[model samples]
Target: MFAALSEKHEHKKVLPDLEGAENGVVMRFAPNPSGPLHIGHARAAALNDAYIKQYGGRYILRIEDTDPKRVDPEAYEMVVEDLKWLSLAITDTVTQSDRLHLYYALCTQLIERNGAYVCTCDNEQFKVLKNKKIACPCRDQSLETNLVLWDKMLTHGFKEGEASVRIKTDLNNPDPAMRDFPAFRILDAPAHPKVIAHVYPLMNFSVVADDHLLGVTHVIRGKDHIANTRRQRYIYDHFGWKVPVYRHYGRMGIEGVVLSTSQMRLGINDGTYTGWDDIRLGTLRALARRGISPDAVKNAMLAIGIGDTDISFSWDNLYSENKKIVDPVANRYFFVPDPVTARIEGAQPHTAHAMLHPSDASRGTRTLEFTGTVLIPKNEVLPEVTMLRLKDLFNVKISWDNGMPTFTYAGDSLADARAAKAHIVQWLPAQATVPCTILTQEGEMSGACEPAVRSELGKVIQFERVGFVKIDGVGDDGVVAYFTHK
Candidate 1:
């Protein structure tokens, strides 16, 4: 499915090659398993996968599950599911929790070479020194003393927040965050979900170490991480290791949507959201539930490309892209929203044939029994309307008598209706119609649709003049569908 969509965009644009990647390219998408994969995360994943496919290189799915406080085992599986849904072919998988020993060993090596030191400064003390643009007192600690403190951190001799190991960087650097940043921090082992190590390596230290050890030749991340890249470079320089080629794209966000994991967690706990898959949320699961195709997401992100300028887009942009993909395949059906029953005078019981798809006649047709009584959308019935054409059926002269709609056969030829400028409206045989509920972004809409919709469960269909919708399921009472887009 994804391969077909990717081919559509192949000729639209060309992506630049990674600098110094002529030897070979190995890219990794390391996501923290604190929450489900959201739209912003999808952009990164898709871009990396595209590069891997284009260059015929390896792609790795690395779970950055080191953060004990926020990590959820279920979220790890959800991330993998989302990647597979995006059709990302991950050649390797690695979980950081299983590599605690490797990080500790590297921490020891850094301390032994005086490249890092353990800082025991309290929060207030460090803030005071940081505000003064001066190095903390621990920066002058001897290599032997720092190593002893580091061992204590690993041995549980110090409590959480009591100490942390800091990498040696320029104290007078313009960016204070880059000055002696924390390499390893003590976590409450009893509170962690997986690993019980009290000392956990921070992202700055862990990612650099894993990238080199895991043979990641190219690193693609958001431009917001430019500072972290500079800090990681110092680590590579200290160890005399070659740094991976870095490609940082500008941050992309959906307008009016917040993708913050912390905020989402709070909303779920506070009952503002049902879960990560809530339709209002931006998580990939949420998008999937709303009938948004993974191919649509990939193509949209590919169009954005890698740039330094921040990009913000409205949901309409996504809908437009999705419409192009679904329009050709989705079958058409008559759906009357908030319908009103009207009796057709001088009408005969006839069988109407509607093409399953306007463009693809090979899909065949649907049969509808046209009885005297029919259901028409309440909104489409205009007060001044003299004539209306039942889409793919016939024209009817409409009249309002005693505030009730009365329909009389006008003609069967579409040419006459088109010449009369008659409104094209959708209608369903009242007795043969089936109940339907459409779940939209705003709220749920109740209506009656052609009985043919019931059999289209798990299929996407166009509701004639209405928007595209996916039939989610069918129960004894009604058929339920999710609105994709117009």
Candidate 2:
């Protein structure tokens, strides 16, 4: 079964080689501190970490936190924690907020080199002219005048949106929006979490300055950033800096969960979501809480590779990868949801010993003592099904007395049970059951589980007829667990 499950993901595709990697590659995973990193954000991170691991190099973690309105103060730590959970190592960490001075110096130099200008034109009016392929009046301002305007932008001489710095690109470029784009802007409201500045550099400008300054050799990001990459390249050419090798994979469309960080934060604020690790959200915190290992995530991502074609995130592929990693060691147990007790007639007290693992005998067995009664899931009982085999125990024929279910003991031979077409089901003795509540994506399911389940706390285990789950808590009330996918 496991072999067939794994064969589905065996594709002939392999990851393409990184250009100029022989010169000691230096890669970075730069994420905006808006919210916790979602699974959609892991592709870039995992690929960069993989390259760094393959070819020894510096892996930098840059927190792009320049947009104050979009920034979440708590997300700084959350981003780091998420990456740590993904096991991506960083040789150095840089916060863009701390390096505003660097961007300012470079902006000033770009003005001096005639690579940029301070545009005082209204945004809408400039767009009208730009769409017509006409340069705004401020685009031709002298270097000295532009420098003075830039100083005003820094010293509150220019109020928010009154003036901005625009990088000088080909005005005749096919894409009008790409012509002389805004590199820096003034925004004085909603004080930034880390820095106190009215003027801030946009993504393209800041990314170019930081990547060049930090000596980043490769930039691996989604194809959605293709326009941004093109804009950044103009900056690199203007300053005559070596542009890094670029590899842009297609957008990863993850289905069946919310991946938008902003939407998740809104849900969390409105009480629609419990937290970052709410199990239904696509954040890494959610995956970790449900016992999905970092290696499984990484392996699943690597299998997808850095392909340019758009792809959806496959939950089946991830579950298959995870099952391969967790199946061999996950102990087996019995749990009954919405349990119903069945009295057994003509049956003697017996001890049933089941293997901890189906094939690993050395791991030993769990001894369950039964006294002519067993608890089974209510859903498994049916009027038409007469005989049922309580797995690893004797077979019993279902009967009704006083409108309540009863079981009459039959022969214990496995072959006889098969001949009777008795459906095997997981059952637990009433004497040795523990209350269990599993937190699933849909909701919580309460039931009775075998006592041995308590010993598997803080580990992943499979219930005999149900899916795998991670034991999260054991308290006076009951055992609390998070249900992982089958």
Candidate 3:
């Protein structure tokens, strides 16, 4: 799938060949309103936005809300919100629900012309003949009978399998989807007020007819929709309607990480994840939580290089790319989690000074006080001995016994400790001790500690000898931190 998307997308910049190419271009970004938008949707939205800006055309955001079984008003609203948050400007007037009359009119025309009919077959019957070529029982129903039943659907109620208006396409065809295809099914969709009269298909035929009405010249989406394109092509052929140019791209998949909406919901419900923003997942919240910028995603897509073919990418490449962009600007801070405090043996107390961003000084510098002792996360490393790093600070001297050692200010003051070329510096105070909260991947951890040297809030900084830290927020208790390593 990735290969196919690559080859076709290589020439994506070129104008697609279509019947109305002379009239100008009108492409549609039609995503189903099933769940909150994910990274995959973001890419498609980005491509659509870019296309409209580059080409002489309009990009229509058509809510394929035709799938009633899976629609959620919250998810639907979020789709728009997420796209807009990513800096996508979409026209507000384009939604499939707004044009339901067109879909119904087409179904009515097909039924009257013997191109469609009402099917009385239930799921069991349909399944039995799914593989075998079977003619629907109501295919030959009088147009008057179908019209009356259709009215019943609109005015009263439609029972399950009571009637389905199927397009009278080739019944002998091998493709089960197109074999006597059911164009509309009676649905009690919650998003739309429960109306008994309307029947909808599985998105294929509906999009084909509606795109013509809305003047959509092109269609770009995931490869999963390619088969639907084939079915839609058949409908267009039957109606003698012009088909839109289609470009399918590889569905973005994170390496070794199968993050889906279902997985996310399950994790949240089971207490395994904080919420949709869990860093391990791919939702917008997760990206924001991980401190990944929106531009990072867009640039990554560009760097990965789009194609109308399927391509599998390793996560390391993305990680490396992000690291390159962040290395120069990330501020330096001191963060020690599950902290264990140590005092520099009899060192004079003084304030520490450090640059926020060691490589890029424009961010300015911050002051931290090393009252004499420093705090460090109690991990595999022992904090009670020599050879300690102020993290982003220089190495310090320590006085040790058989195994344990008292702290010594072998390194510079807080400022001097961080003034060197090192990448991280953690502040330990020689002053009073206080209870501290440690941030970990699993959750918040608690411990006792002294002031750790840090520059600013909501910035990415490395502990001189500790782990990476993200300042969640500052409070009366202490600053909230999240550890980031890989």
Candidate 4:
């Protein structure tokens, strides 16, 4: 519960001071440590970090663990780890859980100044005023009575559906949030562990006090939190504090589906994905499962700078960006799943060498130990044809006939293999293992998808004949379990 400290940086608008001169202003990524960080949080955290990096201001990582029901050491640690993995910089860290007393103290001070009061109400009581500008019965209590009541509530502690504290405001205002809103309430169901300990004015106590005390000169959060900003501004106004510059961008939405951190947490915990790293769900862990490099993630997300509008793009675009980052350095490797053992029927056990990368010979070469028999990994053989990498196999067309895997040496030549399309794939003998799992959609399974390795897991890899090879798991025989394009 140390008083909030601000990080300083130097920027002269046009020039940055080299010797630690007058670096002024500060910004932070404040996230609730209630659940795991999701795509929305990632975007907000990234933008805020990028802004601070650009302007040479301090980028602080503040944990708004005010919701005692969900706050925890684990959640705080996870947020820190997740943000770091996302390439967001944190010059400092703070947790709100450690500062509850400070907030309560501030609330008490407001009550003392006759700006707040205590009110006893139940569930039906708050709902009656939920959207209406109706005044609570205790709004007009004298300062003495307000103080006494507030003290009573403070000493009496909060219970489920019981008394609460209210900020005396314009009861007839059109904005329901503005009409004599409760500054604090009994939380029988607090977000964190200390639910019954202290009542809170969700936005007022959490947002306003934190921002001002932390010297957050600029707010780079998502638009979802924008409504709370108005209430926050009111608190600032009451304290006569200068408001910070606000940048509210719409939360990022992944292709075809809407994803919220709230939603992700439910899906992730309820077995909707393979943990959080299912690769297809738009979570950072999902990105990692796809073998995405941090640079690729930052590049793709950062491509769209901070904007008011939400970012929406196909899952493919993100993979495409990730491919750009991973393609160059990813060592060429070959994998065939659901192996339909392909016997070339007497093709000599020969060593075929191909460039690791045709365009860049410096990448070296790999020698495919082609024997008379090869495991075509049935997953790779699709009704459609795809090229099979022969270790260093340059674009090679694979054809399946009569359940055997074979290479077409003439129709497609070595010259053709250089093009990405050169890798043609089909059954070695025109028929392979009856279809297997394909791990696409990187999301974990709830009922069936859990550990269901389909083609989605290999979203970043392109299969020659099949769309993509979905690696399900490593097999006991040293073979990989795979499913064709899902």
Off by over 4 Å in 1: 1-11, 269-271
Mind giving the per-residue lDDT tens digits that candidate 4 earns over 244-336? 877677666666432455666677789875565555465665555545556555655556656677667545655566555444434333334
lDDT of 3 by residue, 47-67 (tens): 766666656577677788776
Instruction: RMSD for all candidates, in order, please.
Output: 2.5, 2.5, 6.3, 8.8
Q: Least accurate stretch of 10 residues (summed lDDT) in model 4?
A: 1-10
The TM-score values for the models, in the order shown, are 0.95, 0.95, 0.80, 0.74
lDDT of 1 by residue, 299-414 (tens): 78887888888888557867877877787778999889999887888877878888998866889999988888889888878888878888777889988887677789887899
Scored by lDDT, model 4 comes in at 0.56
User: What is the overall TM-score of model 3 with all chains considered together?
Assistant: 0.80
What ranges in model 3 sit over 4 Å off? 1-24, 142-145, 188-198, 255-258, 269-272, 305-310, 377-395, 411-425, 430-469, 483-486
If both were scored by TM-score, which would come out higher, candidate 1 or candidate 3? 1
Using TM-score as the measure, name the better of candidate 1 and candidate 4. Answer: 1
Candidate 2, which segments miss by more than 4 Å at Cα?
1-13, 400-404
Local error of candidate 2 at residue 137 (angstroms): 1.6
Our tally of clashes for model 2 stands at 0
- CA lDDT of every candidate: 0.85, 0.90, 0.63, 0.56
